[model samples]
Target: MPRAVRSPADFWSGALFAGFGIAFAVAALAYEPGRATRMGPGFFPFALAVVLSLIGLATLVRSWLRAGPPPLGLTSRPMVLVLGAVVAFGAMLHALGLAAALCFVVLVSASASSRFRWPRALLLAGAVSGLSVLVFATALQLPIPVLGRWLGG
Candidate 1:
């Protein structure tokens, strides 16, 4: 008897990963992928894509062998909110800076959950924003201003 997929989520995720990997690997070929020693623009991407494809293939095979919980159906509200949160981060990053953007994203995305609470969300936002600022700005010394131009940084 032929084995069937035991985990639809894993199967689909693997398919997506493999599909994108293959597409990226193919696209990488358009650029000059020099030898490993020399290294070209396409080499790193091509290599990563190949690895991604392999991982995806492995996941797909495992999906057929193991059982797992079914994938959750997508909800419009959460989807929109999550996606919008990302967009908001990008929009705010330049003017408000990384710190504010991080907080905004966390709060906005957190609101998508049914049990959303303002105080918890605020705490999370503060933690996330503070951590990001410490890592990206303080430690890495990235060019992004802490408060941004709008805030007179």
Candidate 2:
């Protein structure tokens, strides 16, 4: 008889990784990969897909070799808060602009952690927002405004 999977976490993660890798690899075929000397837009994605597939294969093999506890169930609190943070960022980006959106996302997501504190959350939000503005706005010169129409930019 065939051996069953001993680790649910490994088996599920491997399947998910393999699925994503195959999907990305197939999608990459539509674009030109170019040569190794001068890679095209598709080359990096294709290479990454191959690496992901290999990791998945290793994990799948490990699932059969070693016994492990069953995967823990997902919690709604963290999931909801994190997803909310992403949505908040998207919703606020155009209206409040990048800095505010980044700060909002950080604060909301930080609330999901058990060790969350207001002072720490605010500090982290400020640091990340400032760094993001420095990198994407000042340094990279992305066209996104620091403040939007809602904030009288």
Candidate 3:
């Protein structure tokens, strides 16, 4: 294996993913078992951990085969900006409602394009938010928050 100081970023990322995957898998094992007859609280988390571990291992293997793993492949500015938006979006939900959360997710996710416009964005965000509120939270009964209880509207 040629280790002539190739891209260090790949090695690090692979290591990090590996660590996270292993940690999640280990955590799954520690979850409490079913109480009486049905699956317990640990069921979902445990299943998710297994999938994560498999993906992490595959990533590590591929990176090893590829020449110096590409860096985290994220730009510094976009990363920071997106992270800030995510935090702000979550914070807004507490003050707003399910409508706000749906809007935030849609708007923030759509913002990756340079051609995004406020008017179009708002229209699309509002439509999607309204549909989500009506369908999943109401028709499907997904137990989502509404603007009424908090906003008294």
Give the best candidate by lDDT: 2
lDDT of 2 by residue, 61-119 (tens): 88899887777978999999999999988888888999899999999999999999999
By TM-score, is 2 or 3 better?
A: 2
Candidate 3 Cα errors over 4 Å, as ranges: 1-4, 14-69, 81-86, 148-150
Q: Whole-model lDDT for model 2 versus the true structure?
A: 0.90
RMSD of model 2, in Å? 6.0
Clashing pairs in 3: none
lDDT of 3 by residue, 6-72 (tens): 5557566656777787787787778775755788877777777777767766656665666664466
Worst 10 residues of 2 by lDDT: 1-10
- Which of the predicted structures, 1 or 2, would earn the higher lDDT when compared with the native? 2
Superior by TM-score: candidate 1 or candidate 3: 3
Order candidates by lDDT, high to low: 2, 1, 3
List the pairs of residues colliding in candidate 1: none
- Model 1, TM vs. native: 0.53
By TM-score: ranked, best first: 2, 3, 1
- TM-scores vs. true structure, each candidate: 0.53, 0.55, 0.54
Candidate 2 segments exceeding 4 Å error: 1-71
Q: After superposition, how far is residue 41 of candidate 3 from its true place, in Å?
A: 18
